[model samples]
Target: MAKKDDRGREGEERAARYLEERGYRVWDRNWRCPQGEIDIVADDGRDLVMVEVKTRRTDRFGHPFSAVDRRKRERLWRLAHAWMRAHPGAARGRSVRIDLIGITGERPATAVLEHLEDLR
Candidate 1:
């Protein structure tokens, strides 16, 4: 895979581990459809979380989370709805939330991870 793709996958994995460590059960990774893609789909106790994972080797331009602009957020929202429509049971009881996971650094061991929940 391309270097950037590799970095992104690594970041997603790290984000998943971080959430799992905090008790989130990850249900899917890299879920894609015609609308868009969700980096991670997880259950955080009482909510179904749709996560966007952004990874950067350095923040020269901006923090990784900065990449998740309003347009991207809109696309994510649509994707979340698409996911719910496809998997109705996943949203039966729990609330749906959008989350952002930003990772900055070259390696997982030293990467800085920041998770922002309920983005919308």
Candidate 2:
């Protein structure tokens, strides 16, 4: 994999661990379809969470979370629907939520991470 890809995967692993520590059970990672990709899909007990993870080596350009723009949010919404359709049983009895996780640092273990939930 490319270095950037490795960095992203590392960030995602960190994000997954973070969520797991908070009691969320992760069901999927890097889920892709014609619409787009969801970095993480997890169950937070009462909700099905679709997470978009953005990782950066530094904030020289901007914060990682700032990369999730309007267009990206729209794509995530579509991907969330696609995921539900593809995994019907998982969606049952659970509310759907969109979440964003941002990580900034060279090392995954010591990265600065932020999670924003419930986008539109």
Candidate 3:
């Protein structure tokens, strides 16, 4: 795989671990529908969180969170709706929120991670 792809996967894993540690029950990774992909689907008790994981090798270009543009957000919203429709039982009682997990640096080192809630 390409270097950037590998980095992104690593970031997603890190985000999963972080959420797990915080008591989020992870339901899916890379949940896909016709609209787009959701990096993580987790149940946070009262809500379902659709997460976007962004990883950057360096902070020189920009922060990883900045990568989530308007079009991407819209696609994620559509995908989340599709996921809920496909699993109506899981959808009814809970709220939906879009979250962002930004990670910086390499593996085997301290990766800086930030969780931004309710992005959409």
Clash count list over all predictions: 0, 0, 0
The whole-model C-alpha lDDT of candidate 1 against the native structure comes to 0.91
Q: Cα lDDT of all candidates, in order?
A: 0.91, 0.93, 0.88
- Model 2 lDDT at residue 120: 74
Q: List the candidate numbers ranked by TM-score, top first.
A: 1, 2, 3
What RMSD, rounded to one decimal, does every model reach? 0.9, 0.9, 1.4
Task: For candidate 2, give the lDDT of residue 41.
Answer: 99
Model 3: per-residue lDDT, tens digit, 1-120?
Answer: 898888888889889989999999999999887777889999988899999998887778898888889988898788889989988888897789999998987761368998999996
What lDDT score is found at residue 24 in candidate 1?
95
* lDDT over C-alpha atoms for residue 4 of model 3: 82
lDDT of 2 by residue, 1-120 (tens): 799999999999999999999999999999989877899999999999999999999999999878888998898989999999999999987899999999999897799999998987
Cα deviation at 68, candidate 3, in Å, is: 1.1
- For model 2, where is the 10-residue window of minimal lDDT? 64-73
User: What local lDDT does model 3 show for residue 3?
Assistant: 81
The top-ranked prediction according to lDDT is 2
What's model 3's overall lDDT?
0.88
Off by over 4 Å in 1: none
TM-score of each: 0.96, 0.95, 0.93
Question: For model 3, what is the error of residue 77's alpha carbon versus the real structure, in angstroms, after optimal superposition?
Answer: 0.7
Candidate 2 deviant stretches above 4 angstroms? none
